[model samples]
Structure formats: structure tokens, C-alpha cells
Target chain A: MNKTGKKIFINGNEAIAEAAIIAGCRFYAGYPITPQNQIPEYMSWRMPEAGGVFIQAESELAAINMVFGASLTGTRAMTSSSSPGISLKQEGISYMAGCELPGVIVNMQRGGPGLGNIQGSQADYFQATKGGGHGDYRMPVLAPSTIPEAIEHVMTAFDLADMYRTPVMLLSDGILGQMMEAVEFPVYKSKKKLPEKDWILDGAKNRKPRSVFSLMMQNPTILEKHNYKLAEKYKKMETEVIHETYLAEDAEILVCAYGIMGRICRGAIDMARKEGVKAGLFRPVTVWPFASEVVSKLGKKAKKVLVVELNLGQMVEDIRLAVEDNKKISFFGKPGGAVATKEEIFAKIKELIK
Target chain B: MKAVYTKPISLTETANSYCPGCGHGLVHRLVAEVIDELGVRERTIGIAPVGCAVFAYDYFNFDVTEAPHGRPPAVATAIKRCLPDRIVFTYQGDGDLASIGTNEIIHAANRGENITVIFINNAVYGMTGGQMAPTTLEGMKTTTTTKGRDVKVAGHPLRVSELLSSIEGAVYIERVTVIDPANVIKAKKAIKKAFQNQIDKKGFSFVEVLSPCPINWGLKPLDALKFIKEKMMEYFKLGVIKDSTNSKESK
Candidate 1:
């Protein structure tokens, strides 16, 4: 039994798996993919111990579909994969979104576009925040900068998914997935407090039979109405935007990033501050319902805003959209799994201040 | 006032969208009847496929969820795994089962998923207007195969029942048709047994019903039945392909 605030040395992938188990995830289906394979490996043994079900699906497609099925039963279901595998799962994810089935999908992203590399990259930022699947849909994406934060984010993702009756994503990366860190696991939450899933299909029983589907071909009007309803839900979800600002209250240079890049920027900003440069970090934890208001407000106060990422300027586009003033924002990116070092980022901040 | 020919309570009052003379309605009735007979209607969950039976959730008066195109088996596998005590089944068409969803079905059977599969093999892509299915008969004419399905190009019609029976995890596999009253009875029996095997905790029961598609086959309703008897049945034999239920009956 995991006690409250039990600290342990754990890898990111295993931490995520254990965190999900603590979050009341009773069913998990996943296919083996790089960087995220430890998640399934850990789940295979731990799930059985927790009296949960674990399936090594034939493909990422099957794994996601299995999660979809499990989700319909009102079980806390999840699936994790790297970039390529996550691409294959988009079909089922789209279906789940259309059906309003709630589940958590973890994308321990590696280099992408197509089987790019087994190294950490934030190239999937656009894919994760935008509708990766084919639909007018948005999923809440939580990007954790550290292992301990990843645990809390995983729990938050499940709660958000169930609260909104929608799919939520815990967006991690290969570096975070492979690294080990000291983490304090929160106590397992009892499922009793979770919102009742009155719409779930555990057989009709005494109630009227229910159907879950996305095919509105029979009536286009029905689909149109559903689309507008989803838009309203997304508008409501925009309020859940979360972010963190480090020493930005009095800074001329605001370095904006997320996930591992956020942690790196914090280090770089500190290095600049030590050397008499007014630099700070702005990290959006929920990248989808982005902390645009905070970024917009902070960007106005700062003389220059620099966006850094593992990919070639993905989230920078969102920052640009948020900060609006094209002249005030700049981007420094390392494409194709190459990570930015603290010195490299500090140099960019120094140049921006000058 | 004997209740002899009353509609099965498991079926809803929704008017089926299936074409006149289509076997789906009959098979639906049979499945509903089996659920009623087994007294599992309250605990039965159906996974509907994306083809003609996409609206099965509306027809079946029990909880039903739609699976993506050709993914009913995979969906059913998860549902059964999550709720072991609840009866779970998937209804899929020839194109959905034999073509796109082959991987899911094969693996589900191999894993011995305790669920039932009702495979309606109409031998052509009926919903999409008479396209060539993997189970489309050799030299058969359809919209995609205007020159008749070339076995050299399109491959032979898949014998799903025979293929699934070869797997050790599959406890029961049968192929039956609903061309006439006798064959319809046999198909019903096969479907019932498939559900019963699931109820008895036997693993991976499958029943492949060789059905008729009058509109897709470009034949009259009566002629479509004749076509099944004369052409379809000869290619896909009617019998229990495998039965390990009795060999290891322990529910």
C-alpha cells in the first residue's frame, strides 16, 4: 500500500505507471514503443498486483481501441506510447473524443515526423495541443517538467478527463521518461469521490439501454449540435489553463518554454540573473488550454521574450499568437532531438537583453 | 392467449434500417431471442461495427457501444476484460471482420478472450455499395469487381471460421447460413451456442453466418436466397468448424 507522501527513487516511466495505478486506473493497454516501453513493462507486473488488467496489444491501434472499450465500462483506463505509436492511436482517440469517453493517454515523445529517433524532443507539441486526430476536438494536455510533477499531473489528467468527460493527455518526453528522480508519491485516491459515470455502459440493467457512438451520418443536424456543444465545453475548459512564472515579476527578458525545456530555461534564467541580467522563465504546464493570458501579460512587461524548445519553434507559434507583438518575441530552437543546454540558452538571453 | 410469436423483449421497437430481405434483421432477432432465453439481457453488452450494423446500438435494447471500422473484436476484448461477469459480444460484417479487422480477431482468439463474435459474411461490402470484400467469392461480380472478382488479384474468399478454429484459444467456431428456414435455424443455434459458451466462461466463441445481400448482389430478395443456397453455401460449408466447449466444460 502506497502511504501518503512516500518518497522513492524512481524512473519517469515507472513513476507514471505507478501514479496511474494510484489514480485508480484499473485497465491499461499499450504497444511497445521506444522511451515509453518501461511504462508497459512496469504496468505488466504492477497492474496484476493491483488487481487491474494489463494487455500488451498487437498494435498501438489495438491498444487505443482497447482503452476505448475499457473507458466505456467506466474504468479508469490509460495507454502510453512514443511519437510513432501515438500517431497510430489518433484514430481511436478521435473516436473516444467523439463519444465523450474519458481516458488518459501518455505520449512520452521522442523525435518525430516519422520514426525520427529514440531521443527526447518536443516536436509533438503541435500534435499534442492541436487536434492530432481528424476532428474539431481539443484534449487537455498536461506537460510536467519533472518526475514528481509528472505524478501529480497524471493524477490531474485522470481527474480532468473524468470531470469533463473527455480524454486528457500527460505529455512527457524521452528524457523525462528515461531519467530517474527522487519522487514523493501521493496516496491512492478512493474512487468513491469521483463523479458518478451514469452514462457508462455496464449493461443496461434496470435503466434504459444506452448507445455510445460518433456516427451522425443519419442526421447531420445532430452532429452539428454536438459540435457546438463540444465547443462550449472547450470554452469552459479554457479556464483550467495552468502555468508557472519564475522570477518574472521584475525581469526584462522572459524566456518561455514547457516540459523539460521549462526546467532548462529556469537554469539558464538563473545563470543570467547571477550575472546581472534581468531574465526569468515562463512555463505553461497545461499546453493546450495554454496560459496565454499570463504569457500575454508577462510578455507586455518584459522588453524581450525568447521561446526555446527541443523542436524547431513549435510552441513558439502559440507564444507568438499569445504575445501578439511579433517584435517583442523571438525563438531559439534545437530541431531533431537535440536539447538546448543552459549555457546555450543563457547566451540567447544575454543577446536578447543587449 | 399463449405468447408464442411475440417479439423478443431484447429487441427495441426501432424499425431496423437494414434492407428488405437482409439477413441482419433475422440475425438480430435471433441474437435478441438468445439473450432473452439466457436471461442475460440485463447484463449483455454489444459492440457494434462500422458497416451496415453501425446502428445496432439502437436496435438492441441493451447497452451497446460502437467500435471503429473493423475494431469490434479489439473493443469487445477490452469490455470483457473490464467486466468479466457481463456478457460481451461483437457484431461485424464481412469487410469489417475478414479484411480490416483480421489482426484484432486473430489475436483476440489467440488470447482466449472470453467473448462472443457474430460475423455476418455477406461476401461483399454491402454498406459501401457492393465493393469486393476479402470474403467475396472468386469470379463474383460487384461494383468494384465489374469483371468479377479475380482470385489471382483479389485472393480467395476467407474462411474465418476455419481459420479461427485452428487457434487453441478458440473454444467454439461454427459457420452457418440463413438462406432458408432450416439454415436459419442452424445459424440461430450456432449463435446461441456461441453466447452460451461465453456465459459458461469458455473462451473465444465465434459464429460466422453466411448471409445474403440482395441489393449488393443485384438480385431480387428471393433470388438472393437462391444465390446463397446455390453459390454461397457451396463455397462456405455449414457445420461446426471446432468445438472444445464440451471437452472442457467448467463454468
Candidate 2:
């Protein structure tokens, strides 16, 4: 193992790929998609050196299914894609979720409801947080605002996936995925003792045969029982929900955002503070199983809330649901690849404070 | 009294959900028997496709995972890659292989993934009630291709074995039928050879079985067998489509 703790200059995609390799991801299958192409390109040669398997899958559909097969064998498998590509991957993701298999999916968000531009956008907030695929299921969606957080989230995503025996999504956008930064990739060590994968399909050998499948068509009651079992697992996963607060201890105007928007809001918050406005930021690190309670508490303390995103008010709805009281809540969005500047967010914060 | 024949140890006591004269049951038994004969039952993994054989995991008393419709090849590719020592194979029907899963099957064959594929070609979507498959015979009457499958519109039946045989990565490819006792025996031999090729690490091996879906074809079980022997075999010729393994042995 290369035990170097030295910081390396890297982009978000390479950082995530290297971090995944270091986090013990041994199987990667993905197709080339813009904004996240560097991930598959980096894994191509790096995976072979790390004694892992990497295949440039034929399509996004095939890539996710390949990850499914590898994960069934209890190997740390992952696939990465951009917006439209991720839409193609939903079927396999649903299967992995239904089968209760452990795998990591990284979606470097690009603008889309269709084949949208390759530029960075957060329009996929609804797709990522809500059930993007068919079925009543949820994946722990981790949103990292910076390169370092991207690395940490990749590792955490793997750990969470294995712990819960469920697929996890590390949601990043094109801005963070393409931005260059100096990040010191940490050596990952699991804090909790992850459960042994007693149900993996590594051949029958000395035990009764095991099957990993979700086709419960024989009985509706059986399928309902399985859904309840998954519900219980999701309830247990609530304890793992994470968020970050920046200068929100005594702020009256709360700026709520996530992913790159969160980082942008932080800069805006600092500027707002310098201008004598008590503006703060609330960022949910994990979008699904969201930071509802914390946001609600913060909303009660703050006189008003300003939700900012690079999309047309996706996460703002979640904030509204969390902060259920009729506080003066406002939203500022830049939909479809329109990059939001820190000055723009600061301006929005100024309006909210007024 | 010595036992002349018995069920393969790899098969479970769970009764199959196949139709009265479906070829899946017979083919499943052949595969299980081959796994037993090769002594790889304990170290074998099967990928079941979405079709009538969706419950194959229950029938095969070994580690099995169900892949989405027409994606067993992709799934088996990863399983074999992850655990190369374990024998991995996929069982697919016409709709699952020749139609919806065409890309996956083609790519897997092209990559020469060290896996076995049991391609059962009944020429119709048996599970979904006799829709026109990619391999549906020209002029054959399917629910989707009512009156008859128009050659101009529906196109010709896909000879997947012949198509895959042309790929350099595919080391072995054979097309056989299970319409009669003699043909059944030949089909088993082909299936066994496919598994043996994987055991020897001879790249990709495929066996396409001309199966009988009696209910879907709207025929009696006996007539279904006769149909495969008489009409299906005329278009999908039986026998080895490609065998680079034999040439390698000669060399």
C-alpha cells in the first residue's frame, strides 16, 4: 500500500477515482460521459495496477448491471456517470436497491431533463434525493461541496453501502468534478465494524446455495414483507444522516444549499457578514435521509430562510418541508447550466436579510 | 438392483414452473447434470434471465442471481471477472438474448468473457405470451406479428450462433435442438463441451438450443417437438457453428 500522506494537486474526478481505489473498490465498469470522463480514464490504468478489474462498458445500462454482478460477489464495485447517463442507469440501480446489494454509484451532475449541456448544474437534486428509479426505494445520496469532501464522501459511501447492504450515491456536479484543487486523500479506516457479507453469491461451497434476487412475483404479501424490511433498514439509516452549519449559531438569515451551491453560499455568507448582515449557511452533506431536523431547528431560530441552488428550486421544496413553519422563505435559482457566482448568492442573501 | 439413472445433485427438489412441454426444464436438467459431471457444482454461479426461467435460482441448487431482462451476459461477465476461479454461466431465452439483450450479448461475446451461455431459442417470448422475438421465423404467426411475420417489416430471424461465431473472441459456438431423444443427447454433449471449455479457460463458449415453447406456439407438446425438427431446424441449422478449440488441439 502506498502510505504517502502527501497532498496532490488533482481534479474532482481523479480525486474521486483514486479515493475509490484506496477505499478498496476493486471493480469498476463505466462508459465515457462528459464531466465525469476523467474518472473512467483514470481507473482504466490505475485499476490494473491496484489489482482490480475495470471495463469500459458498452453503455450506461450495461455498466450499472456489471457493477451489480460484481457487487453480488461481495466485491467493492462502482460506476460513474453524468446526468443523462445516470438516467440510463436507473434500472440497474433499482435492481441493486431491490436485491439489497452493496455498490457505489457516482453521478457527476450535468444540466439535464434531456441531453442537457456538459456544464455544471444541480438540477438533478430531485432525481438524486427522490426515488430516481422505479420502486419505493432510497439510496444514501452524499453531496460533497469540495474536492476534499468528495474524497471523504467516496470512502464514506463505500462504508455506508457495505454497512447497510444497499447501494449508495455520491452526488457531485460538473463544477466540483472539473475544478482543480490540492487534496490530501486520507487513508480510509472504517469507524464501525461493518457486517460480514453472509449473503454474497461466491458459490455454494460448504453451505446451502444462496441467491441474490428481487423477483417476488409469486406472492404480493411476500413483496410487501420485503418492502417493509427495506423500510426498517432505511429507518435505521436515518442515524447516518449528516449536515454542516457555517456561522449558523446565532444568524437571523439562513442560506440553505448543498453540494457546490453550499460552498458558493459559504463565500456569500462571509461577504454578507462583512456587510453587517447576520447571514449563515446550512448544508446537508447527505441529501436523502436529509438534514430535516437540523434545518427545522435552524429555521426556527432564524427569522427567514434563503435557499440557493443552481437549479429551479429543487432542494428548496425539501427545505420548505423540513422548515414546516410559515417562516419567510425565499429561493434563488439558476437553472440549466447557468453558473451562479458568489456575488449573485450574496445579493440574494442581502435581499433575504432586508 | 442398481440405480440406472438419478437426478443430478446440483438440481433442487423445488418443482420447476415451466410449461408442460417447455424445453427449459430439459435444458436446465442437462446443465445441472453437466455441472455435476464436471465436479464444479460447488464452485459454479448461474445468472438467470427474466423470462419463464426467472425462477431458475430456485431450481438450481447453487449460487444464482437473477439479471434484468436480457442482461444476464453482462451480469455473468462481471461475476466471472470478479471470481475467475468460479464457473459462471447465463441461461437466456430468445427475447432476452436475441432481442432486448442484443448489445450485451454481442459485447460479452466480443470481449471473449470466460463464461458459458445457454441460449434457448423458442422463437417467441414465452413468458410474455408469444410476442414476436428477434429470432422469430419469417412468416411465423406470433401475437405481435399477427396474420404472419412480414419479411419486409418484421425482418429475418437472427442466427445468433452464426453471428457470434464470426467474432474472434468466441472460441466455441454451437447450435443444437432438444426435439428428440437423439437430439437431446447431442444438446447435452454440446452443453458439457461448453462448460468444459470454460473449465479449460478457452475464452467464450456458447450453446444455442432450439427449444420448444408448446403453449406459446399454440401446438401440442408432440407437435412442438415436430415443429422444431421440421421447420425451425431448416432455418436455424443444427451442429457446430464455430469451434476454434478443435483447431487448437490439432495444432
Candidate 3:
């Protein structure tokens, strides 16, 4: 409780860690990687101080799996990594989704097809939003455009994970991770102590023995039952999808974006508005379990939808699906290390309007 | 009136899910007896591996968490750190411990995490139908090693306990086989000592128990035990490779 209404100047990584602690995260396992190394460093020291567990796993694969183990015990757990390391964690993330374990994964994205760079890039948009691992499962992904949003999303990520009993991702980039910002800490609550062994594998002494497993035995009907249960959980998540629209009521061209690009798109929309052009912005806060209805309702009024992103057009696919080909849509993006600047986005909007 | 020998104290009354003569049941019982004897049952947390023993959570009488393949050590590391006063251990099969989970186990040992690792080395993958495993012996037949593990291609079997003993962080490392009554006694002693080391906060302690997988080995129950003694032991030698107690006494 510092001055400025519980406000503190902190970096993005520290904010993420602080948010996790406030959310009652008792376990953190991660490997060191640039841009997001502060996350593991903060947890390594803070978790121990808070009577939580912190482990610097040997690799990203082990780190994510460690989170899987702790989460299975009905504990709030998380791991953070960059692009290449996040790629290693995909298998475990996929398994967590399959098993319906509640956990959070933070991707402080860097450039990559492979070991691309330690610098910031949104190249992982497709990997974060779409199911990166080998499965038909969807991880609810939150893209944070600002440091405050990064902290807010970290808190929301835990609620969403527990709400749906699934893994959630906080998709950020190096700039946001390393940047410092003024943030107010959330009120901390000591987690209500639940029976540790209620559903966990603490030897079968006090209650009926339990198991946390993802393998559906070779029985097809049982597998189908588990899949059906998962489908029902996903259906409940649809009601929680969220987004924001700015000046879209009379716009003829809609600019759809998310994460950092969404922030830049808002700037572009402002520039277009000054020129007396009817341009509006749709910023999706939740990338997966997407805000499709909002996009469709806005699509009805706009003549053309221009999707802008820092990746090679990943969110554009979701926009297309939401609009359902009913509106003319085109995508303008910069892949690899290039970012979509406000001027570049404004040019794209002008082109689309013509 | 005489008391009958029944399921051990740390184990629940649940019937085992293991195949007949599988070594997991024996090892689980042995671990349970040790926990009960040590009076740490209430404070112990067990980590189950991904294999036939994955459901160990159902039979073991303690709080347990099932880990993904080869991740028990990492999970155990967290639990022990969070609850330092609690006794935490991970029970894993050969494939889950020695293969994909190699890095997790080695790093945990090297970091000297205060936990016990009960490794069941049954030579073959029992759950997924007798696949070739990292511990599968040379000249032995498995579904994946139909031609008898070709050393040139697959490499020789790994001796995990001996390998782990070399790490300075490991406080205790022992390998014991449970094929016969005598060997079962030795295996129990080894497991008990491993747990005792953790109770003493000695650092990482590992007990690799040589188990039998009758279903995967294509042999009868007795024959599987015989195979473990006659064939598997030749590749995986049994003995204590490290004891930090001796080092502590010397100091």
C-alpha cells in the first residue's frame, strides 16, 4: 500500500508476478529467457517470501509440466517464457487443455520461426490465439496492449482459467514486458485453504483416493464422454467473451485489432477521424473464445473492415470468421520484426476506404 | 487370534489397478509401510508418474498429484518448497523417469532438492504395451525393440541410480531389485533409507527399485521374476552407490 492510491511504478514482468500473487498463485516454475526473465526472477525471490513455491526448471518443457502438476493439485500455478521456449511448452499446454487443468501461461513474445531474436515481435499471434499444440482444444488467450492491461489481464487470466477449468495465456511482447508503468496493486486475499488432498494424490488416508490424469483409456465411449464434457465447458466460456469499440456507430470502415496493434489502430482511427473520414476501431481483449457477436454487429454498419496486426495476419482470420464474408475485408500486417505503425495503418485504412 | 498381513498403512483399501504380479503394488506397499513407520503419513505428499502406476493416487493413502510423463521431479520440487515441513516424494516408472523426464530428475538431484524419488525400473514400458524403454536391456525383446535392442541405433540401457550418484547434490542413491523375498527386503530397506534421508533434510535421495512387468515381458508371474533376476540384473547392477550419512559423519 504505497502512496498514489496503492500505486507503484513497476515493470510489466513484475506486474504480472504481483498480479499472480494477488490471485493466490502458490506455484511458479519457469526457465530464464530474455524480455520476460524478470518474471521468473521476481517469482524466485517473491514466491519464497510469500510462502509459495518457485522452481527454475531445467527447460521450458519441464517448467510447463511442473505447472501442470501443481495445477492438478488444485493450486493456482503459472509459467512464463518467450517464443522459442513457449514453443517447447506447447505439448504440455495442449495436455493441460485436454485434461482441463486451470493454469496461466505468459508469453512475452519475441521474434521467431526459430530463435529469431530477443527483441519484441508479435510473430506468435497465431500460436497464442489458435491452438499451438496438436489438438482441437482452444486456450483462452488474453492480449494485453499496455502494462496496466498486462496486469489486469494477468488477474483476469486466473479467473478465466478457474472459471472454465482450462489453461489461459497472456500474450504480450518484449516491449510491454520490459517497459515500466504506473500500476495500482489489487487488494490481496489470502487464499481460502481448501482440503489439499480432496482431489489430489496425497496417499489415500483421509478420503477416497483420486487421480489427475488426461489419458482417456482405450475406451471410445468414455473418451467421447470426456470430450463432450469439455465441449460443454467451452460453451460456457462463450458468454464471457469481451471487446471494446471506439466511434464505430457511423463509421464506414472498421479497423479490427488486438494486443499492441489494437492500441496503434486506435491512434490510426483518430487520425482518420480528424480527416473527416468515418473510421472506427474494434479492439478485442479476449483473443480466443473471441468476441464474435460484437464484430458481427459492427460489421453490419461498416462497409469495409481493415484488420491490422504485427503478425502475418493471424487475428484477421478470426475477424473474417466473425464477419462471415458478409463484408469486404482486407488485412495489412508486418511480420517478423516489423511493427504496424500508426502512419502505416492509416495508409492501409485510406487504401481500403478507396 | 493372529493379525493378518494386509495392505500397508500408507495405502488405501482400494484394490490395485496393476496387472497380476506387477511390481507397482509391492513397491507402493513398501513405501506406505515406511511412511507409516516413520510417522510422516499425515505430512506426506506423493507425486504419481504417468504410466500404469498413474492411478497410484487412488491406492496411496496421502495427498497425491499425477504428473505428466517425466515431470514428477519438477512437481515434487514445488511441493517440497512450498511445504518445507512436509515429506514429499515422487513415484515413477522407468519410462516416465529415465526417458522423457531425465532432465527434470537430473536437475532436481543436482539442485539438491529436499525430496525422495522412488524409481520403479521394470525394464519395459508396461502401460503402453511393452514398448522399448530407456531401461530395456540389450538383447531383450520389446514391442519397439523387436530385433533385440540394437546398441548402435538405440544405445545401451541407462543405469539411472548410478548415474545420479555422481551428482554432488544427491545425498543418497541406491538400486535394489524385488524379484525374490530376500531382494524384496533389500528394496524395502533402500526405500526406507531414502525416506529417512528426506526426513533428516539430507538433500535429494533416490531409490531405484527393479520391478517386474509380467504383462509386457511375455512371461508368467514366476518367470518374470526369474527374468528380472537372471537377465535384467546383469545390465542393471544392484547396490548403494552413495550415502551422505557417511560423509556427514566423516566431517
lDDT of 3 at A102: 82
DockQ, per-model, please? 0.90, 0.89, 0.50
lDDT of 1: 0.92
- TM-score, chain A only, candidate 2, equals 0.98
Error of 3 at A183 (Å): 3.5
| lDDT (Cα, tens digit) per residue for candidate 3, span A1-354 | 222267789999899998898778889999999989999999999998887888888999989988887776567899999999999999889888887788999999988788888777888878887789987788888888888788777878887887777899999888788889888876654322223323544344555545566777758898788888888878877776778888988879999988878888999999999999899989988888798988988876789999887767778888888888744988887776667789998998888877
What is candidate 1's lDDT per residue for A214-314, written digit by digit as tens? 98986789999999999998998898888999999887899999999999999998899899999988999999899988999899899999999999888
Structural similarity to truth (TM-score) of each candidate = 0.98, 0.98, 0.92
Q: Rate the local accuracy (lDDT) of all candidates.
A: 0.92, 0.92, 0.84
On residues A30-58, what C-alpha lDDT tens digit does candidate 2 reach at each position?
A: 99989999999999999989999999999
Model 2 Cα shift for residue B163 (angstroms): 1.5
Residue A336 shift from truth in candidate 1, angstroms: 2.1
How far out, in Å, is residue B206 in model 3? Answer: 1.0
Docking class of 2: high
lDDT of 3 at A64: 92
Ranking by DockQ: 1, 2, 3
| Ranked candidates (TM-score, high to low) | 2, 1, 3
**For residue B85, what is the lDDT in candidate 1?**
98
Q: Residue B170 in model 3: shift from native, Å? A: 1.1
